[model samples]
Target: MASEAAPGSIGGAGTALPRHVAIIMDGNGRWAKKRFLPRFAGHKAGVEAVRAVTRAARAIGIEAMTLYAFSSENWRRPEEEVSDLMGLLRIFIRSDIDELVQENVRLRVIGDYRRFAPDLVKLVDDAIARTAANSGPILVIALNYGAQAEIAAAARSLAAKVVAGEMAVEAIDDAAIERELDTHDLPPLDLLIRTSGEVRLSNFLLWQAAYAELLFVDTLWPDFDAAALHQAVTTFAQRQRRYGGL
Candidate 1:
């Protein structure tokens, strides 16, 4: 487990806790392999980790938490695995909805829902609606998501507007693209963390993470805990955050 001091204790990190944090949960298969267990077992453990981290984030006053759950590239995996992931999603929603509402967490999913099965889509939509009124942490799950694909989709929409004379070609810019994204209303990511020692973005939030602080950890997704999350936030607070300019 990772470790960091309690939240709001000033004078050490200069009150640098991030308001928003994003995570790319990685290495579930590898973790299962190491344990000589089925890959789905690792995924199950990762779900528990998600629960722990979410509660921890809320406890620390984080305003937003975005999790890269499934990427567009993940569709290439075996059909069985894909189906298992979908099952897990359903289980998560069913098991957590009441708890989430009680905890005041609003859940939002960002991705191409058109690709999901009708039953799964209905479950996701129901979860969103149920938690929409929550006033606590905003939990964003990126399932079936791809940063490149998101950008491409946004561009296609913008291009169509230009062709239809609804928008001038010259007027198209960053803000316009952002408005077209699935996460338009959310604030930019303040910290991006990846588990299982992976060092790549894996096509997650490419546009929004342009100025985010990153924390890499070797712990597998299943093993990530509140301690790990706190450490990540503490590390984020220590950074300079110069953005694009010094």
Candidate 2:
């Protein structure tokens, strides 16, 4: 990772550099294992990678970035690991809000807020509020988020609306379904990158990424840097995004 991130190594030619980049950050535990360190240490180091990627994206003129910080499936992990992640997130919110504001970056979280601790939830809300007016890149963190759950929730909400006489059952369409989703106002993803050599989507952004250019890399989440991102972007640039048709 260190060798890859050395100056003048990233953002090379053929980098498609999509306006919106969504990442499924993976492999923190594996990275820790390789280093013979605790998994929590990998998570901590991943924070630094997050900062680096955000800065790199901003510098490279990307408009939006969505990171899969924690998925709904992650609850199955050990309690200690989950607790450590929550702690790290709270600290990240407290420590990074000012920097986010200063950089004109807006912070958005897409996930089940109810699952987090009350204090952590409040801190996240506060951070979002503090950065709400920023005009730079929009940084979205998916905490406790799952596309399947989002779709189910949207369907339930739509069903409720139909029952309440607010919307007719026959009137519900794709647009209505989208409006019911948490990502209703966000742009569709242009590129989806997964690190740690993982080729699977792992249930991240299923709907939004339907038309996105997908890229996978061997670099672990804790080690992913500007160079890794540049590689993904460059690969994205090389592909012709047909969007399901020629």
Tell me the spans in candidate 1 whose CA falls farther than 4 Å from its real position. 1-14
Off by over 4 Å in 2: 1-16
How would you encode candidate 2's per-residue C-alpha lDDT over 1-246 as one tens digit per residue?
Answer: 222232222344424557778999998999999999999989999999998888888777777899999999999999999999999998888888888999999999999976788998889888989988888779999999999999999999999999999999999988898898887877778999999997999989898887888888888998899877766766777789886788
Error of 1 at 170 (Å): 2.1
lDDT of 1 by residue, 1-246 (tens): 333334453224447667779999998899899999999998998999999999888777778999999999999999999989989988999999999999999999999975899999999998899999888789999989999999999999999999999989999988999999988989788999999997999999999998899888999999889888877876777789776788
**What total of clashing residue pairs does each candidate reach?**
0, 2
Worst 10 residues of 2 by lDDT: 1-10
TM-score of each: 0.93, 0.91
Q: Compared to the true structure, candidate 1 yields what TM-score?
A: 0.93
* Reference-based lDDT, each prediction: 0.87, 0.85
